[model samples]
Target: MKMRSLIATALVAALPGVACAQEVTLSFAHWLPPTHPLQPTGFEPWIESIKEASGGRIAIDIYPAQQLGAAADHYDMARDGIADIAWINPGYQPGRFPLHAIGELPLMMSDAKSGSRAFDAWYRTYAPEEMSDVYYCMTHSHDPGTFHSKEPVRTPADIAGKNVRPAHATMARWVSLMGGASVQVPAPEAREAIAKGAADMITFPWGSIFIFGIDKEVKHHLDTPLYVSSQAIVMNKDMVEGLPDDLRKVIDDHCTPEWTEKVVSGWVDAEAAGRQRMIDEGHTLYKPTAEDLAAWRESAAPLTEEWMASVNKRGIDAQAAYDAYVASLREAGALMGEN
Candidate 1:
């Protein structure tokens, strides 16, 4: 024990920064537990990449598995400077991120990369103003949401009366429009809800199917594309403002609007991993027929108009934001794997 301690002390002494230098350690908190393989292989690599890119002068302390608080409380935590940084799901607190929720509208994303690009593009084109409080780093989604249900959802009518968890308010509305009872719950909490008969199914990025152990509770996964909800990594304004210009530039370089799409591609990868898990666990995966998709689209259309009206009541130019999002989606379509 003494020899081991001596070696540790010697190593710390050998590294000037490791010894007595009070390295400015920035804390980054997220809701996922460290055991989620996606973090070490995916999100954690981004951390390592930034550190290597910065030559270790800046160190980030990552707190995952909701070490700080519940998922829904993360945004309030970040806004209040509970931590230097965090990845927050805007949908977790519905009213606070009213405008940013536009990304969650139906069928806006096709794949993670394009969805991310489209999300980044959408944020730039329509909702940059919504993120003024924090240093907004990126906007992206899980690959694309799909239905993990107690029963197969191969047809539109299957949604009727089922307790489905939707990604956003609009999604919940969409479910309700199609006759499902949309429940709003954090994905982390969805597993227990399903196992305990609290929720019948959920529409989320495929990853939650595995991350939250939904495969064991739900036997079927709908193969049709659902809209992607935007999630972001943000830094407290005070911490961001205090950074040296060079260090700030480093963050800027890494967290670029374009780089954001690249960095967040993990979400899609995580979703894919979840889908594969579903297959491995013997869950039935089904795709809706063309006629069924048409039925879904027709049923869900009114929710879009309803969203516009709600956003309009919030005093921003709803038409402009809506139009911009639609236009950006059209432009983002090719990138999103749409013809």
Candidate 2:
């Protein structure tokens, strides 16, 4: 009896070390504050899902608010293993990701859920070459974005001479095309820029302005779906490739078109809530008339032509990609306000 007891104690003592040896922990990095909807409503729940799906074999450590690095550096941080995974805004790097600019195009899709699913599907076809250095998890966008400014901007003419904060390269070009000076400010710093008179306007998803506390500084809001910001979550190639089969499958399961939609759908509700909040606050909200929408569309026409021309130079069939995206949006019933 004494000999049996000693053996059982020794086996129990070794169990924790054995479990630690078999478990894997991945680091996830992003720039959003902890209280942002994307964190608590989207990513945190998704992380829990991954942990449950992996049966405790995989664990994830989340670093929010650029704890690992700057927002623009997130892609390379994951690529270089600064974090095993990162939420990256490809548009932040400008021309480096022209293909991704499809999601950033003016008046593209209506809501984040359908748009993100389409983006994930479309980007998968190009991920092999465009995001070759990293393991592409998924691509998503915020709900349609619009101008939040100090003064009412009802037409293209109002944009001229306004110093606007652009969320990405395409928007930057759009600002320049409309004769506005582009003020480069990441979302977190946009409030200060506007407060200091460095930027008179900014383009963002409806809810993000409120989440970032920029709503307090801006008195005018464009009640139009002007554009959306393209974003992705990627993993280090080496880390993905090195994972055991079961663990890799867990990651793969979480990185699907369905998951992309799930992650971004919450933001759609948040956008509506934010817009309503602004209206309740008595901020000047301009709802464009049909003629106003027509003029704005006409003004943005040249940007599409320029984008196609640039992508063609890189040997991409840009028109086909754009056409496919439009088709997907139509099929999903996510055209202008259809959602």
Candidate 3:
């Protein structure tokens, strides 16, 4: 029996394909807290799918809350191989990815689920050029974000001279356009900025106000799906290219629009629930009137123009790209018509 076992082991080891079937382990790094909804609701299930799909040959270790790198540095971390995969807020490093800024445009989409599907599908075309440093896996957005402030912001003019912490670069630009000053800070540091009065307001998704403890400092909420900030899950380019075919197939299968929608659904539901939580807590929710909405949209119009000019300067067909993005949103029924 012992001789038979030895012969079997020897036979397995001698086969070239069997010898190369060693398990692959990867590091996934993100800046959200371990308890954040994205951790359990989005990333874990996706990770599990990959593990099962690969027959336990691939293992991913998650390093959350900036354990591996800073929030803004995540893209670079993945590119440099500091992390095998990273969750990146592309707008964190403004102007670096001009083509991707289309997703951050104000009032472009109404919800995260369908919007995520549209954004992920549309981005695949541009990712190879805009985010070429890394292997683009999937892209998603939070539920649309609105203003939360110590003081009420009823109109675009209300932002004038105020200090606001924006969700992304496009929001920062919008704040500036409205004559407000932007207190640029990453998500983990947002609560501190608001508490210290460095920022008197924040543009954030409804659910994260409580998740990041920003609700304690802000009492007024704007009832609008003003904008959605885009996020990407990317992998190291060289590592992806060097992977064995079977292992690479596992990764590829998980990086599709289907997987993106599945992962973002939980977060979308959680964030949508925050509106009721705020209401129950007696926080003031300000709904915009038709005129107010029109004014806000007018103020945001230049943002698209700015994006177009900026990307055109980068030698891209900006108009064509914008049209495609809008087409994707319309197809998904996520686009909010001009109001």
**By lDDT, who's the top model here?**
3
- Write one digit per residue (lDDT tens) for candidate 3, span 228-250: 99999999999888777988999
lDDT of 1 by residue, 1-339 (tens): 123434654666688666432124577888887876547765677777767766674677788988988888776677678877788888777666767777777765676666566666667643456767778777766677877888878766888879987877777878887788977777777888888898898887777677777777888888766677777788777777766676676677766556766666665676777777777777798877777777777886786776677778878788888777666656766233365
List the global CA lDDT of all models: 0.72, 0.85, 0.91
Error of 1 at 311 (Å): 3.1
Alpha-carbon runs more than 4 Å astray in model 3: 1-19
State the lDDT of candidate 2 residue by residue for 1-339, as single tens digits.
123434654576588665332466778999988788887778888999998998976778899999999989999999999999899999889878777787888887786788789778878888878889999999988888899999888998999999999999889998898899999977888889999999999998888888888888888988988898989999999988977788789899999999999987886788768888888888889999989999988888887888788778789998997788787777777666556
TM of each candidate vs. truth: 0.86, 0.93, 0.94
- The worst-scoring run of ten residues by lDDT in candidate 1 lies at 1-10
Lowest summed lDDT across 10 adjacent residues in model 2 is found at 1-10
Error of 2 at 237 (Å): 0.5
Rank by TM-score, highest first: 3, 2, 1
By TM-score, the best candidate is 3
lDDT at position 101, candidate 3:
85
RMSD of each: 5.3, 5.4, 4.5
